[model samples]
Target: METNTQILSTEDLRSQEYFLNMGPQHPATHGVLRLLLTMDGEIVKNIEPDLGYIHRGIEKMVEYDTYRQIIHVTDRLDYLSSHMNNEAVALAIEKALEVEVSDRIKVIRTMMDELTRIASHLLWWGVMGMDIGALTTFMYAFRDREMINEIMEKTTGARLTMSYNIPGGVMFDLHPDFVKDVKAFIPHMRKVLPEYDRLLTGNIIFQRRMKGVGYLSAEDAISHGASGPVARGSGVRCDIRKKAPYSAYDRVEFDEIIETGGDNLARYQVRMREMYESLNILEQLVDNIPEGPYQMPMRTLIKLPKGEFYQRVETARGEFGVFIVSDGKKNPYRVKFRSPGFSNLNALIQAGRGVKLADLVAIMSTFDFVIPDIDR
Candidate 1:
């Protein structure tokens, strides 16, 4: 028997690059998002995020929705940051109408914002650990997160996408037990937060996986318009709460968490530290909640003056802005949302280059994307 012998060129024997689809249904993606990745074996050479898997035409839909009704639509954009999303649209409408809400409204909105931030961070922390193989962190995180959800449910009558915030102020006043429950949650979170650090932040294996992975420099972060923890991780001072204070954030004193490491670890550290700051914010405001009408009185048919209006708020993930063009009608002529997830995902494409496939998951966990926010 004669066997056929053939020689192959060096180029022909080299490994070939190929494309891989990561999501639209993957657990690590956290939502309905698909990432088109170009890979050379285990290394990710390029990443192009394919979004809109969950698009609901929220922006265009708002054009037909009354100003009051639009608040609920914003809730679905970044469901985790629902309160902040509500506040953004409410604030823009208030700005357009030139209606200054009561001090009570401002303080309550601010407190609720912090609560939402803590809840969002808690879920992210839990999911991040699970993505990296630590399953226990999920239970620990949800345990604390349930406390906040309970508080919100009591006040807003809805847990997740609570459209408690309306254009003028809020749908209703805080629950009678709202302050007490929040105050109780503060200390509990303070005690348990350190446990989180011990469980995941200090884990050597976690650190080795995340510390130097997915590096995004400050310049690149700003160029890509990354905000919230993603930009802060790279030492960018882009906190809208600090730069432009709205709702009672100007009254609170808390350090803006910033980490200069410019890596997945740095991003993780920023959010971890932010949880403490959220607690600090809640501590400062829970007891000092002002007394007055939770919502301001407005015409039954609310119509913004014909012009352009814009408002920005610091949500759990980053800066969330709402821009509205009104035609002096109850509904807006056009509306747009400046969602943080989209910008942070843009930054991810830069940070993810050159990282291994496994490391990409950790980096994405650090980014903490909410798919609807990006797709919207």
Candidate 2:
């Protein structure tokens, strides 16, 4: 008696490529973002970010709103970077109108900008750890972040979307305790940041998950227009604050954190180090805040000349730019926003290729995306 048997070919044993949808409503995404991932078994072959779930048509709305009104809408784009978003629009409007804000206003804006950076980074740090299976980090991060939120509420009357930065200057003067609160927070944060290093950064498990994963080269970073920690992690000097000084950034001394590793770990290190740099910027400004009016005198209706204007600022994510086309009207004839999240998300298509599905979560966390910013 003989048995009939057949051996499988190499191609027959191999797996076929398939598609997976990560989210428009997944926890790791951090917002309403859908990632259409092409998968070859457990490895990601390509990633297409499906946006617009949270798009509010902010740019189109701004065209109908006054320059002052435009400031408020920008806050909704990158709510974590709301202050910086407001500043971008305000700076563009001021540039179009040829208004120079006072030195005091400049200093206050810079200090607040740094505080916002710290707060945003804190949130990202905690969330990133949580994304990779460390829940304790979320609690610790929010603990420090609350202090900054309280400070924002006291001064700007809002925590998430302050809309504090107006066209001419900030909407109001700093709270009487602003400097004292910031001064106290700096020391507290400096002490606690190291704890974060011990808790997550040095974890052997985390290191294994991050190191050498999702490599994005410096040249690719530039070609993809990646900025903030995403670019800096790859050793690209794309910090708008350093390259083109705006507000009181020129008055401060702080190093732009750069890591040449071009991996997920490098991005993580860049942000972690950036928190220290933001603290340095705050220490220099908090005590030395000048004595002057918080806001410049401006016409009730701000009308830009019949021309175009653009301003870019370094936000928590990266370059946040506002461009306006005016037909000599109180409202802009056309409006556009250059948001960092959109560019950074696009770069993932390259960095994420050939990475594991699990590693995709780690790589995306490093991006620190705000979905509305991408969709808008």
lDDT of 2 by residue, 1-376 (tens): 5333333444555678899999998989988999999998899998988888998998888888887888888889999989999888888888888899999999988988999999999999999999999999999999999999999999999999998998888988889998889888999999999999999999999999999999999999999999889999999998999899999999899998999999999999999999999999998888888898888999999888999888899999998888888999788889989999999998888899999999999999998899999999
- Poorest lDDT segment (10 consecutive residues) of candidate 1: 1-10
Q: How accurate is candidate 1 locally (lDDT)?
A: 0.92
lDDT of 1 at 161: 96
Judging by TM-score against the true structure, name the best candidate. 2
Which TM-score value belongs to model 2? 0.97
For candidate 1, lDDT tens digit of each residue in 154-197?
99999999998887889888889998898789989999999998
